[model samples]
Target: MPVVVVAWVLLILLGWSLVYWPHLPSGFVFGSGLDSSARASWTDAVYLSAVTLATLGFGDIVPADGWLRIAVPVEALLGFPLITAAVSWVLQVYPALTRRRALAVRLSLLRRVDTVGLVAGQRSVLAASVLENLAMSMAQLRGDLTQFSETYNVRDADQNLSLPAMLGVATELTEAARRSAVPDVRHAGELVEAAVGDYLDVVDKQFLRVGGSAQKIAAAYADDYGQRIAPAVSGG
Candidate 1:
């Protein structure tokens, strides 16, 4: 996001520079009473552009010519909307990002337990409850991911909260179920696997539409999940 903002600022600066370039010699007035003696260099023009774009109006530089006099105000007018849009985008994405992180943490808890622990005869009830809760969490996460994919059109860089992480969690739950002698625990695991599969189908369609790096990332995730997690989970 910082990179995006910086790129926008640079583009704005370039546009302003071009607008001021032609009238550089006689149109700009610098403070400290150098209005007549000071010629507008590229640096001075850029400084004025930055000030106007930021709506700073530091009173250190002024536009003297008729064209520049009109241009400065227009630039200032554009500044507010551009800044507002950038801030709005960040604000809108923050909640989705927070939810993604929270889901990742919840899913990570499944990693701490071994199959034996989850499948034990005495702990069968606890294991069933855990798998049920995990399935519910994955369902909620699937909704969040769908919303995120629609909004962003790109995969998140954070592996912990990414599609792969969800796959890992689902696979782990399935493996535990297969290992368990208890029928309830196995049923709970099936629920989680079905939910995760549906979620992956949604993601697959989204990535296919987005294409390029996003498609590649989705493919890589599938490969990793299939090769490493699926075999163990399926008892193959």
Candidate 2:
């Protein structure tokens, strides 16, 4: 969001400089000496820049230069891309943050249930119930990621199906755990733990993949071909 704000500020200054600079009472020139008319116009330009950057466009200063005329449309062009990148970054990070919070909640709930089961020595029943809740939460996360993939088209290389496939495997494990009623509670508990571990691993990989995709899209949107995120080289 700050990046977007700064971009708009710079863009607005560019527009205002291009606009009244040509038609000022003193002259259309950079670094002109300040006089009564020049200072007032300069202040007006500053005001206009603030409004334009805020997208207020208060109708005070208008462009008059023919050759410098392209600034208005150019500012508009730059604004949209900056705004889009800001929005996309929010969209990518917000869901991942939400999922992390949800996962923490699920884990806490499972631990409470586990303690209760151990106290009652009805380990298998409690474990199964915990597994069911975890499964449901995982299913919800899968649905959220599916919508993300469809909206962003980030997984288009695999026909937008890789995440769905991974989620399906998680669902299958949960279903199997739900159906098993073995007498060995320890074995059932171990199976559920293994399944959860595997699901977590898959989810981690998917997150890495999606994060990479978002970084690429954002850099492209910024027109940063030189990889500004690259580590700086130091002299030996």
Candidate 3:
């Protein structure tokens, strides 16, 4: 968990540095032309970076030079996606870490059991483990759903088809675990396996969505480049 936190912090800092480091001269206004007095020092550069990246545009300090002006807009563009990626990574990993800790607690309880003649206790342990697994799975699924919801709040059909699909898988697993006569430890494992299979089916569909999106992007780029190069190719 600490590692994930540190990694995200480093990534955010690196992203900020990428946008702000180039114009670090001492107080230079962006696009102030090549000879402008606005040489941005380190502190000034960082301040300007915050304003530009945030789109605050206080207007107290402006980009008077061409590259600085160009750099400002580029930074703004990068800021949105960088911040989005950082937030998304944090949202995904935090719940996963919480689930890991919960799972560890359940496993610790499981490890102390003696396995000899403890039929009733073994059933209890099986039941507890099943519940723990289901809970963890649901937490993760909820996190995914919340993220998808936030990403597209309008709830359109194609906006987020996977959210309900994941919820359905979780519900089914909960139902399987609720079965009273799930039998001994052997069948308990089988029940867990079945639940996992359903979840993985949803995961596979998510991967397919990614591939489909990539293909669309590739086709668009190919068509665009073909148009730009067609005249030159014909002349040649």
Q: Using Cα atoms with residue i matched to residue i, what is each candidate's TM-score against the true structure?
A: 0.59, 0.41, 0.38
Q: Candidate 2 on 1-236: residue-level lDDT in tens?
A: 44555776576676665565445633323333434354445655556455555455554444446543456555545556666766786677567546634554444333333333342254566655555555555555545554453322232122112232223233333344444554444455445445444444444454433233422433332232222221111112
Local distance difference test values of all predictions, in order = 0.66, 0.45, 0.44
lDDT of 1 by residue, 207-235 (tens): 53433443244455555444222222222
**Total clashes, candidate 3?**
22
Give the per-residue lDDT digits (tens) of candidate 3, residues 1-236.
Answer: 33454575455545665556565553245453444355545555566666666666676666556766776677677567656766777686556544534433333333234221232234657564655565556455435534442222222132012232123322333344445444543355344445444433433354323233422432332232231111101111
Q: Once superposed on the true structure, which residue ranges of model 1 sit more than 4 Å away at CA?
A: 1-8, 33-36, 92-95, 113-166, 174-191, 198-219, 222-236
TM match of model 3 to true structure: 0.38
TM-score of 1: 0.59
- Give the local distance difference test score of model 1: 0.66
C-alpha lDDT (0 to 100) for residue 119 of candidate 1 = 50
